[model samples]
Target: MRAVTYDSYASDNSRLKVGRVPDPKVGPGQVLIEVRAAGVNPVDWKVMTGGLDGMMDAMFPVIPGWDVAGVVRGRGPDTPDFVDGDEVMSYARKDVVGAGTFAQYVAVAADDVARKPASLDWNQAGGLPLVGMTAQRSLDRLEVGQGDVLLIHAASGGVGSLGVQIARDRGARVIGTASEENHEFLRGLGAEPVAYGDGLVERVRELAPDGVTAVADFVGGQLDTTLAVLAEGGRHVSVADNTVDQHGGHWIWVRPSGAKLAELAAMADRGALTVEVAGTYPLEKVGEAFDASRTGHTRGKLVITP
Candidate 1:
Protein backbone atom coordinates (compact mmCIF):
# COMPACT_ATOMS: atom_id res chain seq x y z
CA MET A 1 0.00 0.00 0.00
CA ARG A 2 1.20 3.50 -0.76
CA ALA A 3 1.31 5.78 2.30
CA VAL A 4 2.56 9.21 3.34
CA THR A 5 4.40 8.99 6.62
CA TYR A 6 7.33 10.70 8.30
CA ASP A 7 10.03 8.76 10.15
CA SER A 8 10.50 11.33 12.92
CA TYR A 9 8.57 14.22 14.43
CA ALA A 10 9.69 16.47 11.60
CA SER A 11 8.50 20.06 11.44
CA ASP A 12 5.86 20.20 8.72
CA ASN A 13 7.29 23.54 7.59
CA SER A 14 10.74 22.02 7.19
CA ARG A 15 10.53 18.34 6.22
CA LEU A 16 7.83 15.80 5.47
CA LYS A 17 7.53 13.28 2.62
CA VAL A 18 5.16 10.81 1.02
CA GLY A 19 5.90 7.40 -0.47
CA ARG A 20 4.95 3.69 -0.34
CA VAL A 21 4.76 1.38 2.65
CA PRO A 22 3.37 -2.04 3.65
CA ASP A 23 -0.37 -2.55 4.16
CA PRO A 24 -1.87 -2.81 7.63
CA LYS A 25 -3.08 -6.06 9.19
CA VAL A 26 -6.56 -6.46 10.64
CA GLY A 27 -6.66 -7.82 14.15
CA PRO A 28 -9.56 -8.99 16.27
CA GLY A 29 -12.52 -6.58 16.41
CA GLN A 30 -10.99 -4.59 13.55
CA VAL A 31 -11.92 -4.12 9.90
CA LEU A 32 -9.40 -3.59 7.14
CA ILE A 33 -10.23 -0.90 4.62
CA GLU A 34 -8.62 -0.27 1.24
CA VAL A 35 -8.22 3.44 1.81
CA ARG A 36 -9.66 5.77 -0.82
CA ALA A 37 -9.58 9.19 0.81
CA ALA A 38 -8.21 10.58 4.06
CA GLY A 39 -9.46 13.71 5.77
CA VAL A 40 -6.69 16.13 6.79
CA ASN A 41 -7.28 17.80 10.15
CA PRO A 42 -5.27 20.24 12.27
CA VAL A 43 -4.28 17.46 14.63
CA ASP A 44 -2.44 15.58 11.87
CA TRP A 45 0.02 18.42 11.39
CA LYS A 46 0.21 19.15 15.11
CA VAL A 47 1.29 15.55 15.65
CA MET A 48 3.77 15.80 12.78
CA THR A 49 5.36 18.90 14.31
CA GLY A 50 5.71 17.17 17.70
CA GLY A 51 2.76 19.06 19.24
CA LEU A 52 1.24 15.82 20.45
CA ASP A 53 4.32 13.61 20.39
CA GLY A 54 4.95 14.40 24.03
CA MET A 55 1.97 12.28 24.99
CA MET A 56 2.99 8.82 26.12
CA ASP A 57 0.73 7.13 23.59
CA ALA A 58 2.03 8.95 20.52
CA MET A 59 4.69 6.91 18.71
CA PHE A 60 7.36 8.03 16.26
CA PRO A 61 7.24 7.11 12.55
CA VAL A 62 3.48 7.47 12.83
CA ILE A 63 1.08 7.96 9.93
CA PRO A 64 -1.04 10.82 11.27
CA GLY A 65 -4.57 10.41 9.97
CA TRP A 66 -7.82 9.62 11.71
CA ASP A 67 -10.71 9.92 9.26
CA VAL A 68 -11.02 7.36 6.44
CA ALA A 69 -13.37 6.23 3.66
CA GLY A 70 -13.00 3.09 1.56
CA VAL A 71 -14.20 -0.39 0.76
CA VAL A 72 -13.77 -3.09 3.31
CA ARG A 73 -11.06 -5.60 2.51
CA GLY A 74 -11.09 -7.63 5.74
CA ARG A 75 -13.08 -7.95 8.94
CA GLY A 76 -12.15 -9.61 12.17
CA PRO A 77 -13.90 -12.82 13.15
CA ASP A 78 -15.89 -10.99 15.79
CA THR A 79 -17.00 -8.23 13.44
CA PRO A 80 -20.49 -9.49 12.58
CA ASP A 81 -22.09 -6.20 11.41
CA PHE A 82 -20.05 -5.98 8.18
CA VAL A 83 -18.18 -8.08 5.65
CA ASP A 84 -15.72 -7.55 2.83
CA GLY A 85 -16.76 -5.14 0.04
CA ASP A 86 -18.84 -2.83 2.22
CA GLU A 87 -18.18 0.89 1.85
CA VAL A 88 -17.23 2.39 5.19
CA MET A 89 -15.96 5.49 6.98
CA SER A 90 -14.00 5.60 10.20
CA TYR A 91 -11.83 7.79 12.47
CA ALA A 92 -9.08 5.57 13.73
CA ARG A 93 -8.73 5.98 17.49
CA LYS A 94 -5.67 8.09 18.29
CA ASP A 95 -4.49 7.49 21.84
CA VAL A 96 -2.97 4.05 22.44
CA VAL A 97 -5.71 2.57 20.28
CA GLY A 98 -4.50 2.43 16.62
CA ALA A 99 -2.64 3.81 13.65
CA GLY A 100 -4.08 6.01 10.84
CA THR A 101 -5.64 6.24 7.36
CA PHE A 102 -2.93 8.25 5.54
CA ALA A 103 -2.10 5.10 3.61
CA GLN A 104 -3.98 3.01 1.05
CA TYR A 105 -5.15 0.60 3.72
CA VAL A 106 -6.19 0.95 7.39
CA ALA A 107 -7.33 -1.63 9.94
CA VAL A 108 -9.93 0.24 11.97
CA ALA A 109 -11.99 -1.19 14.77
CA ALA A 110 -15.44 -2.27 13.58
CA ASP A 111 -17.20 -0.11 16.15
CA ASP A 112 -15.58 3.01 14.68
CA VAL A 113 -16.59 2.27 11.06
CA ALA A 114 -19.94 3.47 9.71
CA ARG A 115 -21.47 2.95 6.30
CA LYS A 116 -20.43 5.86 4.07
CA PRO A 117 -23.34 7.89 2.77
CA ALA A 118 -24.20 6.54 -0.67
CA SER A 119 -24.79 10.02 -2.06
CA LEU A 120 -21.22 11.15 -1.37
CA ASP A 121 -18.07 10.19 -3.26
CA TRP A 122 -15.02 8.86 -1.44
CA ASN A 123 -13.46 12.27 -0.79
CA GLN A 124 -16.66 13.76 0.57
CA ALA A 125 -17.31 10.71 2.70
CA GLY A 126 -13.78 10.78 4.05
CA GLY A 127 -13.89 14.49 4.85
CA LEU A 128 -17.27 14.34 6.57
CA PRO A 129 -16.47 11.85 9.33
CA LEU A 130 -14.06 13.83 11.48
CA VAL A 131 -15.54 17.30 11.11
CA GLY A 132 -19.15 16.19 10.92
CA MET A 133 -18.73 13.94 13.88
CA THR A 134 -17.04 16.75 15.76
CA ALA A 135 -19.71 19.31 14.97
CA GLN A 136 -22.54 16.93 15.74
CA ARG A 137 -20.98 15.91 19.01
CA SER A 138 -20.28 19.51 19.96
CA LEU A 139 -23.89 20.53 19.32
CA ASP A 140 -25.03 17.52 21.25
CA ARG A 141 -22.94 18.83 24.10
CA LEU A 142 -24.46 22.25 23.58
CA GLU A 143 -27.98 20.73 23.47
CA VAL A 144 -29.09 22.92 20.54
CA GLY A 145 -32.50 22.57 18.89
CA GLN A 146 -35.67 24.38 17.83
CA GLY A 147 -35.99 28.07 18.70
CA ASP A 148 -32.47 28.09 20.09
CA VAL A 149 -30.06 30.76 18.86
CA LEU A 150 -26.57 29.33 18.30
CA LEU A 151 -23.35 31.23 17.67
CA ILE A 152 -20.43 29.48 15.99
CA HIS A 153 -16.95 30.97 15.59
CA ALA A 154 -14.81 30.40 12.50
CA ALA A 155 -17.96 29.78 10.49
CA SER A 156 -16.20 29.25 7.12
CA GLY A 157 -13.80 26.58 8.34
CA GLY A 158 -14.45 22.84 8.14
CA VAL A 159 -16.17 22.05 11.44
CA GLY A 160 -17.83 25.45 11.72
CA SER A 161 -19.35 25.27 8.23
CA LEU A 162 -20.89 21.90 8.99
CA GLY A 163 -21.85 23.02 12.48
CA VAL A 164 -23.78 25.99 11.15
CA GLN A 165 -25.73 23.82 8.72
CA ILE A 166 -26.50 21.16 11.29
CA ALA A 167 -27.71 23.74 13.79
CA ARG A 168 -30.11 25.18 11.23
CA ASP A 169 -31.32 21.71 10.19
CA ARG A 170 -32.26 21.03 13.78
CA GLY A 171 -34.46 24.17 13.76
CA ALA A 172 -32.08 26.51 15.56
CA ARG A 173 -31.37 29.99 14.23
CA VAL A 174 -27.59 30.10 13.88
CA ILE A 175 -25.39 33.22 14.04
CA GLY A 176 -21.82 32.60 12.91
CA THR A 177 -18.61 34.62 13.40
CA ALA A 178 -16.17 34.78 10.49
CA SER A 179 -14.50 37.50 8.46
CA GLU A 180 -16.58 40.03 6.57
CA GLU A 181 -15.53 38.42 3.27
CA ASN A 182 -16.95 34.97 4.07
CA HIS A 183 -20.15 36.40 5.51
CA GLU A 184 -22.07 35.84 2.30
CA PHE A 185 -20.91 32.23 2.06
CA LEU A 186 -22.03 31.58 5.63
CA ARG A 187 -25.34 33.37 5.17
CA GLY A 188 -26.00 30.99 2.27
CA LEU A 189 -25.63 28.13 4.73
CA GLY A 190 -28.44 29.58 6.92
CA ALA A 191 -26.16 31.28 9.44
CA GLU A 192 -26.08 35.01 9.97
CA PRO A 193 -22.36 35.66 9.66
CA VAL A 194 -20.83 38.34 11.88
CA ALA A 195 -17.31 39.68 11.67
CA TYR A 196 -15.05 38.01 14.23
CA GLY A 197 -13.06 41.05 15.24
CA ASP A 198 -13.26 43.84 17.76
CA GLY A 199 -16.87 44.33 18.77
CA LEU A 200 -17.83 40.74 17.73
CA VAL A 201 -20.20 40.64 20.66
CA GLU A 202 -21.91 43.84 19.54
CA ARG A 203 -22.22 42.51 15.97
CA VAL A 204 -23.68 39.21 17.13
CA ARG A 205 -26.08 41.05 19.41
CA GLU A 206 -27.30 43.07 16.47
CA LEU A 207 -27.95 39.92 14.41
CA ALA A 208 -29.76 37.94 17.09
CA PRO A 209 -31.67 40.84 18.70
CA ASP A 210 -32.99 38.39 21.30
CA GLY A 211 -29.80 36.78 22.62
CA VAL A 212 -27.35 34.03 21.75
CA THR A 213 -28.73 30.80 23.17
CA ALA A 214 -25.47 28.96 22.71
CA VAL A 215 -21.88 29.56 21.66
CA ALA A 216 -19.72 27.00 19.86
CA ASP A 217 -16.25 28.49 19.55
CA PHE A 218 -14.17 26.71 16.92
CA VAL A 219 -11.84 29.70 17.13
CA GLY A 220 -9.63 29.80 20.18
CA GLY A 221 -9.02 33.51 20.83
CA GLN A 222 -11.52 36.04 22.20
CA LEU A 223 -13.15 34.22 25.04
CA ASP A 224 -14.39 37.55 26.32
CA THR A 225 -16.09 38.24 23.02
CA THR A 226 -18.06 35.02 23.29
CA LEU A 227 -18.98 35.72 26.88
CA ALA A 228 -20.12 39.23 26.15
CA VAL A 229 -22.89 38.00 23.82
CA LEU A 230 -23.91 34.73 25.46
CA ALA A 231 -27.22 34.51 27.23
CA GLU A 232 -26.89 33.71 30.89
CA GLY A 233 -26.77 29.90 31.25
CA GLY A 234 -26.26 29.55 27.52
CA ARG A 235 -23.90 26.74 26.62
CA HIS A 236 -20.44 27.95 25.56
CA VAL A 237 -18.71 25.01 24.01
CA SER A 238 -15.16 25.50 22.70
CA VAL A 239 -13.52 22.99 20.38
CA ALA A 240 -9.98 24.41 20.38
CA ASP A 241 -9.54 25.47 23.99
CA ASN A 242 -11.25 26.40 27.24
CA THR A 243 -14.88 27.50 27.14
CA VAL A 244 -14.98 27.85 30.90
CA ASP A 245 -15.02 31.26 32.59
CA GLN A 246 -17.76 33.78 33.47
CA HIS A 247 -19.75 32.34 30.53
CA GLY A 248 -20.06 28.99 32.36
CA GLY A 249 -19.75 26.59 29.40
CA HIS A 250 -17.71 23.45 28.97
CA TRP A 251 -14.60 22.75 26.93
CA ILE A 252 -15.54 20.22 24.25
CA TRP A 253 -13.54 17.52 22.58
CA VAL A 254 -14.89 15.94 19.40
CA ARG A 255 -15.95 12.42 20.16
CA PRO A 256 -16.12 9.67 17.50
CA SER A 257 -19.47 7.91 17.37
CA GLY A 258 -20.81 5.46 14.81
CA ALA A 259 -24.31 6.42 15.91
CA LYS A 260 -23.81 10.16 15.39
CA LEU A 261 -22.08 9.57 12.10
CA ALA A 262 -25.14 7.58 11.02
CA GLU A 263 -27.36 10.60 11.73
CA LEU A 264 -25.07 12.92 9.72
CA ALA A 265 -25.09 10.33 6.92
CA ALA A 266 -28.88 10.41 6.85
CA MET A 267 -28.89 14.21 6.53
CA ALA A 268 -26.40 14.09 3.65
CA ASP A 269 -28.42 11.33 1.99
CA ARG A 270 -31.48 13.54 2.02
CA GLY A 271 -29.58 16.55 0.60
CA ALA A 272 -30.13 18.47 3.82
CA LEU A 273 -26.35 18.54 4.18
CA THR A 274 -23.54 19.33 1.72
CA VAL A 275 -19.73 19.23 1.73
CA GLU A 276 -17.58 22.09 0.45
CA VAL A 277 -14.19 20.83 -0.67
CA ALA A 278 -11.88 23.78 -0.10
CA GLY A 279 -9.09 21.90 -1.86
CA THR A 280 -7.86 18.41 -2.75
CA TYR A 281 -4.35 17.00 -2.65
CA PRO A 282 -2.95 13.58 -3.32
CA LEU A 283 -1.49 11.66 -0.40
CA GLU A 284 2.03 12.67 -1.47
CA LYS A 285 1.16 16.33 -0.93
CA VAL A 286 -0.56 15.98 2.44
CA GLY A 287 2.18 17.92 4.20
CA GLU A 288 1.59 20.95 2.03
CA ALA A 289 -2.12 20.77 2.71
CA PHE A 290 -1.39 20.51 6.42
CA ASP A 291 0.72 23.65 6.24
CA ALA A 292 -2.16 25.46 4.55
CA SER A 293 -4.62 24.36 7.21
CA ARG A 294 -2.54 26.01 9.96
CA THR A 295 -2.72 29.36 8.23
CA GLY A 296 -6.30 29.95 9.58
CA HIS A 297 -8.71 30.52 6.72
CA THR A 298 -9.78 27.35 4.91
CA ARG A 299 -13.05 27.80 3.03
CA GLY A 300 -14.05 24.19 3.73
CA LYS A 301 -12.63 20.77 4.37
CA LEU A 302 -9.21 19.93 2.91
CA VAL A 303 -8.89 16.34 1.64
CA ILE A 304 -6.19 13.88 0.58
CA THR A 305 -6.89 11.24 -2.06
CA PRO A 306 -4.73 8.15 -2.04
Candidate 2:
Protein backbone atom coordinates (compact mmCIF):
# COMPACT_ATOMS: atom_id res chain seq x y z
CA MET A 1 0.00 0.00 0.00
CA ARG A 2 1.09 3.56 -0.68
CA ALA A 3 1.22 5.81 2.38
CA VAL A 4 2.47 9.16 3.62
CA THR A 5 4.41 9.58 6.83
CA TYR A 6 6.47 12.11 8.73
CA ASP A 7 10.02 11.51 9.91
CA SER A 8 10.21 14.54 12.18
CA TYR A 9 7.89 16.82 14.08
CA ALA A 10 7.40 20.38 12.98
CA SER A 11 4.50 22.50 11.85
CA ASP A 12 5.99 22.20 8.39
CA ASN A 13 4.20 20.01 5.86
CA SER A 14 7.44 19.77 3.90
CA ARG A 15 8.41 16.98 6.21
CA LEU A 16 5.72 14.59 4.94
CA LYS A 17 6.77 11.82 2.57
CA VAL A 18 5.02 9.39 0.28
CA GLY A 19 6.23 5.82 0.01
CA ARG A 20 5.23 2.21 -0.34
CA VAL A 21 4.09 0.64 2.92
CA PRO A 22 3.14 -2.96 3.55
CA ASP A 23 -0.57 -3.52 3.99
CA PRO A 24 -1.71 -3.54 7.59
CA LYS A 25 -2.94 -6.78 9.14
CA VAL A 26 -6.15 -6.87 11.16
CA GLY A 27 -5.86 -7.89 14.80
CA PRO A 28 -8.12 -10.45 16.45
CA GLY A 29 -11.07 -8.05 16.16
CA GLN A 30 -9.97 -5.53 13.56
CA VAL A 31 -11.18 -4.84 10.04
CA LEU A 32 -9.07 -3.92 7.03
CA ILE A 33 -10.54 -1.23 4.79
CA GLU A 34 -9.82 -0.63 1.14
CA VAL A 35 -9.46 3.09 1.62
CA ARG A 36 -10.92 5.16 -1.19
CA ALA A 37 -10.75 8.49 0.59
CA ALA A 38 -9.42 9.88 3.86
CA GLY A 39 -10.49 12.98 5.77
CA VAL A 40 -7.88 15.56 6.74
CA ASN A 41 -8.34 17.32 10.08
CA PRO A 42 -6.45 19.97 12.06
CA VAL A 43 -5.03 17.28 14.33
CA ASP A 44 -3.39 15.56 11.37
CA TRP A 45 -0.93 18.42 11.28
CA LYS A 46 -0.60 18.52 15.04
CA VAL A 47 0.48 14.91 15.00
CA MET A 48 3.02 15.51 12.25
CA THR A 49 4.46 18.44 14.18
CA GLY A 50 4.69 16.55 17.43
CA GLY A 51 2.20 18.90 19.02
CA LEU A 52 0.75 15.91 20.84
CA ASP A 53 4.07 14.73 22.22
CA GLY A 54 2.83 15.08 25.77
CA MET A 55 0.17 12.44 25.13
CA MET A 56 1.66 9.12 26.24
CA ASP A 57 0.40 7.38 23.12
CA ALA A 58 2.32 9.64 20.75
CA MET A 59 4.34 7.54 18.31
CA PHE A 60 6.87 8.65 15.72
CA PRO A 61 6.72 7.67 12.04
CA VAL A 62 2.95 8.02 12.40
CA ILE A 63 0.15 7.99 9.86
CA PRO A 64 -1.65 11.15 10.87
CA GLY A 65 -5.35 10.94 10.03
CA TRP A 66 -8.56 9.71 11.70
CA ASP A 67 -11.48 10.24 9.30
CA VAL A 68 -11.77 7.40 6.84
CA ALA A 69 -14.49 6.31 4.40
CA GLY A 70 -14.16 3.32 2.11
CA VAL A 71 -15.09 -0.28 1.28
CA VAL A 72 -14.55 -3.16 3.61
CA ARG A 73 -12.21 -5.63 1.92
CA GLY A 74 -11.56 -7.95 4.88
CA ARG A 75 -12.57 -8.54 8.46
CA GLY A 76 -10.74 -10.31 11.28
CA PRO A 77 -12.27 -13.02 13.44
CA ASP A 78 -14.22 -11.87 16.50
CA THR A 79 -15.57 -8.86 14.54
CA PRO A 80 -19.06 -10.01 13.63
CA ASP A 81 -21.17 -6.99 12.64
CA PHE A 82 -19.69 -6.02 9.22
CA VAL A 83 -18.80 -8.03 6.17
CA ASP A 84 -16.53 -7.56 3.18
CA GLY A 85 -17.74 -5.04 0.55
CA ASP A 86 -19.52 -2.89 3.16
CA GLU A 87 -18.90 0.84 2.90
CA VAL A 88 -18.07 2.52 6.18
CA MET A 89 -16.75 5.77 7.62
CA SER A 90 -15.34 6.65 11.01
CA TYR A 91 -13.05 8.74 13.21
CA ALA A 92 -11.04 5.83 14.56
CA ARG A 93 -9.93 6.16 18.16
CA LYS A 94 -6.46 7.72 18.62
CA ASP A 95 -5.33 5.54 21.47
CA VAL A 96 -2.19 5.04 19.41
CA VAL A 97 -0.49 8.05 17.86
CA GLY A 98 -1.15 7.31 14.18
CA ALA A 99 -2.99 4.32 12.78
CA GLY A 100 -5.94 5.10 10.54
CA THR A 101 -7.31 5.68 7.06
CA PHE A 102 -4.57 7.60 5.21
CA ALA A 103 -3.33 4.89 2.91
CA GLN A 104 -4.71 2.63 0.20
CA TYR A 105 -5.49 0.12 2.98
CA VAL A 106 -5.95 0.61 6.72
CA ALA A 107 -6.65 -1.63 9.67
CA VAL A 108 -9.20 -0.24 12.10
CA ALA A 109 -10.90 -1.70 15.14
CA ALA A 110 -14.42 -2.91 14.31
CA ASP A 111 -15.94 -0.94 17.16
CA ASP A 112 -14.61 2.31 15.63
CA VAL A 113 -16.43 2.36 12.29
CA ALA A 114 -20.00 2.57 10.97
CA ARG A 115 -21.68 2.09 7.62
CA LYS A 116 -21.29 5.08 5.34
CA PRO A 117 -24.29 7.03 4.15
CA ALA A 118 -25.41 5.57 0.82
CA SER A 119 -26.21 9.08 -0.39
CA LEU A 120 -22.62 10.29 -0.12
CA ASP A 121 -19.77 9.32 -2.43
CA TRP A 122 -16.36 8.21 -1.23
CA ASN A 123 -15.05 11.79 -1.48
CA GLN A 124 -17.76 13.24 0.72
CA ALA A 125 -17.82 10.37 3.21
CA GLY A 126 -14.09 10.77 3.69
CA GLY A 127 -14.62 14.17 5.26
CA LEU A 128 -17.64 13.35 7.39
CA PRO A 129 -16.49 11.42 10.42
CA LEU A 130 -14.38 13.74 12.56
CA VAL A 131 -16.13 17.02 11.90
CA GLY A 132 -19.60 15.52 11.81
CA MET A 133 -19.19 13.69 15.10
CA THR A 134 -17.68 16.78 16.72
CA ALA A 135 -20.75 18.80 15.82
CA GLN A 136 -23.15 16.10 17.01
CA ARG A 137 -21.44 15.62 20.36
CA SER A 138 -21.29 19.35 21.01
CA LEU A 139 -25.03 19.76 20.41
CA ASP A 140 -25.83 16.64 22.41
CA ARG A 141 -23.70 17.85 25.31
CA LEU A 142 -25.38 21.25 25.22
CA GLU A 143 -28.90 19.88 24.84
CA VAL A 144 -29.47 22.04 21.79
CA GLY A 145 -33.02 21.44 20.62
CA GLN A 146 -36.05 22.98 18.94
CA GLY A 147 -37.06 26.47 20.03
CA ASP A 148 -33.46 27.23 21.03
CA VAL A 149 -31.12 29.66 19.31
CA LEU A 150 -27.46 28.93 18.54
CA LEU A 151 -24.51 31.19 17.81
CA ILE A 152 -21.71 29.29 16.10
CA HIS A 153 -18.24 30.77 15.95
CA ALA A 154 -16.41 29.74 12.79
CA ALA A 155 -19.70 28.41 11.53
CA SER A 156 -18.23 28.11 8.06
CA GLY A 157 -15.54 25.74 9.33
CA GLY A 158 -15.53 21.92 9.17
CA VAL A 159 -17.38 20.98 12.37
CA GLY A 160 -19.15 24.32 12.60
CA SER A 161 -20.63 24.07 9.11
CA LEU A 162 -22.18 20.67 9.81
CA GLY A 163 -23.23 21.81 13.28
CA VAL A 164 -25.08 24.78 11.79
CA GLN A 165 -26.98 22.56 9.38
CA ILE A 166 -27.78 20.01 12.10
CA ALA A 167 -29.07 22.68 14.44
CA ARG A 168 -31.23 24.10 11.67
CA ASP A 169 -32.59 20.64 10.86
CA ARG A 170 -33.50 20.16 14.53
CA GLY A 171 -35.69 23.32 14.28
CA ALA A 172 -33.36 25.57 16.22
CA ARG A 173 -32.88 29.15 15.08
CA VAL A 174 -29.24 29.44 14.06
CA ILE A 175 -26.82 32.34 13.74
CA GLY A 176 -23.30 31.88 12.37
CA THR A 177 -20.13 33.98 12.20
CA ALA A 178 -17.75 33.70 9.27
CA SER A 179 -15.66 35.95 7.11
CA GLU A 180 -17.45 38.25 4.66
CA GLU A 181 -16.50 35.89 1.81
CA ASN A 182 -18.39 32.95 3.35
CA HIS A 183 -21.48 34.84 4.53
CA GLU A 184 -23.67 33.79 1.63
CA PHE A 185 -22.75 30.12 2.00
CA LEU A 186 -23.51 30.16 5.70
CA ARG A 187 -26.86 31.83 5.08
CA GLY A 188 -27.72 29.17 2.50
CA LEU A 189 -27.02 26.53 5.13
CA GLY A 190 -29.93 28.04 7.17
CA ALA A 191 -28.12 30.40 9.50
CA GLU A 192 -28.23 34.14 9.75
CA PRO A 193 -24.68 35.00 8.66
CA VAL A 194 -22.71 37.56 10.62
CA ALA A 195 -19.18 38.72 9.86
CA TYR A 196 -16.67 37.86 12.57
CA GLY A 197 -14.34 40.53 13.91
CA ASP A 198 -14.58 43.51 16.18
CA GLY A 199 -17.98 43.93 17.79
CA LEU A 200 -19.08 40.38 16.95
CA VAL A 201 -21.00 40.08 20.19
CA GLU A 202 -23.09 43.14 19.40
CA ARG A 203 -23.88 41.87 15.92
CA VAL A 204 -25.06 38.47 17.18
CA ARG A 205 -27.22 40.09 19.83
CA GLU A 206 -28.81 42.27 17.16
CA LEU A 207 -29.76 39.17 15.17
CA ALA A 208 -30.99 37.14 18.14
CA PRO A 209 -33.06 39.54 20.25
CA ASP A 210 -33.70 37.01 22.98
CA GLY A 211 -30.02 35.84 23.12
CA VAL A 212 -28.27 32.72 21.86
CA THR A 213 -28.88 29.66 23.97
CA ALA A 214 -25.58 27.96 23.05
CA VAL A 215 -22.18 28.81 21.62
CA ALA A 216 -19.92 26.26 19.87
CA ASP A 217 -16.61 27.98 19.31
CA PHE A 218 -14.37 26.05 16.94
CA VAL A 219 -11.87 28.87 16.64
CA GLY A 220 -10.27 28.90 20.04
CA GLY A 221 -7.65 30.70 22.17
CA GLN A 222 -9.12 33.41 24.41
CA LEU A 223 -12.83 33.32 23.60
CA ASP A 224 -14.14 35.58 26.33
CA THR A 225 -16.32 37.34 23.78
CA THR A 226 -17.72 34.05 22.52
CA LEU A 227 -18.47 32.87 26.06
CA ALA A 228 -20.21 36.19 26.62
CA VAL A 229 -22.67 35.41 23.85
CA LEU A 230 -23.93 32.25 25.52
CA ALA A 231 -27.23 32.60 27.39
CA GLU A 232 -27.33 31.81 31.08
CA GLY A 233 -26.93 28.07 31.70
CA GLY A 234 -26.13 27.71 28.00
CA ARG A 235 -23.61 25.20 26.72
CA HIS A 236 -20.15 26.34 25.71
CA VAL A 237 -18.08 23.66 23.99
CA SER A 238 -14.63 24.11 22.52
CA VAL A 239 -13.06 21.66 20.09
CA ALA A 240 -9.82 23.60 20.27
CA ASP A 241 -7.92 24.74 23.35
CA ASN A 242 -9.88 22.37 25.57
CA THR A 243 -8.08 23.72 28.60
CA VAL A 244 -9.69 27.13 28.34
CA ASP A 245 -12.12 27.87 31.15
CA GLN A 246 -15.62 29.27 30.67
CA HIS A 247 -18.27 30.92 32.79
CA GLY A 248 -21.29 28.68 32.22
CA GLY A 249 -20.68 25.48 30.22
CA HIS A 250 -18.20 22.65 30.11
CA TRP A 251 -15.40 22.11 27.58
CA ILE A 252 -15.29 19.06 25.30
CA TRP A 253 -12.67 17.30 23.18
CA VAL A 254 -14.32 15.26 20.46
CA ARG A 255 -13.80 11.55 21.21
CA PRO A 256 -14.19 8.69 18.76
CA SER A 257 -17.80 7.47 18.97
CA GLY A 258 -19.17 4.84 16.57
CA ALA A 259 -22.72 5.44 17.82
CA LYS A 260 -22.50 9.15 17.04
CA LEU A 261 -21.09 8.37 13.61
CA ALA A 262 -23.99 6.00 13.05
CA GLU A 263 -26.48 8.78 13.78
CA LEU A 264 -24.62 11.21 11.51
CA ALA A 265 -24.34 8.66 8.74
CA ALA A 266 -28.08 8.02 8.93
CA MET A 267 -28.72 11.75 8.62
CA ALA A 268 -26.51 11.97 5.55
CA ASP A 269 -28.23 8.97 4.05
CA ARG A 270 -31.57 10.71 4.49
CA GLY A 271 -30.27 13.92 2.91
CA ALA A 272 -30.81 15.73 6.21
CA LEU A 273 -27.01 16.25 6.36
CA THR A 274 -24.35 16.99 3.77
CA VAL A 275 -20.56 16.87 3.58
CA GLU A 276 -18.75 19.70 1.82
CA VAL A 277 -15.29 19.27 0.33
CA ALA A 278 -13.00 22.22 -0.21
CA GLY A 279 -10.21 20.26 -1.89
CA THR A 280 -8.84 16.80 -2.62
CA TYR A 281 -5.31 15.52 -3.24
CA PRO A 282 -3.68 12.19 -3.96
CA LEU A 283 -2.24 10.27 -1.03
CA GLU A 284 1.24 10.98 -2.39
CA LYS A 285 0.52 14.64 -1.82
CA VAL A 286 -0.44 14.30 1.81
CA GLY A 287 1.96 17.12 2.58
CA GLU A 288 0.00 19.48 0.38
CA ALA A 289 -3.28 18.25 1.80
CA PHE A 290 -2.16 18.98 5.33
CA ASP A 291 -0.90 22.40 4.24
CA ALA A 292 -4.34 23.31 2.96
CA SER A 293 -6.01 22.06 6.13
CA ARG A 294 -3.86 24.32 8.31
CA THR A 295 -4.75 27.48 6.41
CA GLY A 296 -7.95 27.92 8.47
CA HIS A 297 -9.62 29.23 5.33
CA THR A 298 -10.78 26.05 3.54
CA ARG A 299 -14.39 26.40 2.39
CA GLY A 300 -15.00 22.98 3.89
CA LYS A 301 -12.69 19.95 4.22
CA LEU A 302 -9.31 19.03 2.71
CA VAL A 303 -9.09 15.37 1.70
CA ILE A 304 -6.69 12.74 0.35
CA THR A 305 -7.82 10.05 -2.05
CA PRO A 306 -6.09 6.71 -2.58
Q: Top model by TM-score, which number?
A: 2
User: Model 2, residue 62: displacement in angstroms?
Assistant: 1.0
Q: Report every candidate's CA lDDT.
A: 0.82, 0.82
Number of colliding residue pairs in model 1? 0
Candidate 2, after superposition: displacement of residue 39 in Å? Answer: 0.8
**Best prediction by lDDT:** 2
lDDT tens per residue, model 1, 85-195 = 999898765565236788888888787788999888888888998888888888998889998999898988999999998999999998888888898999899988888
Clashing pairs in 2: none
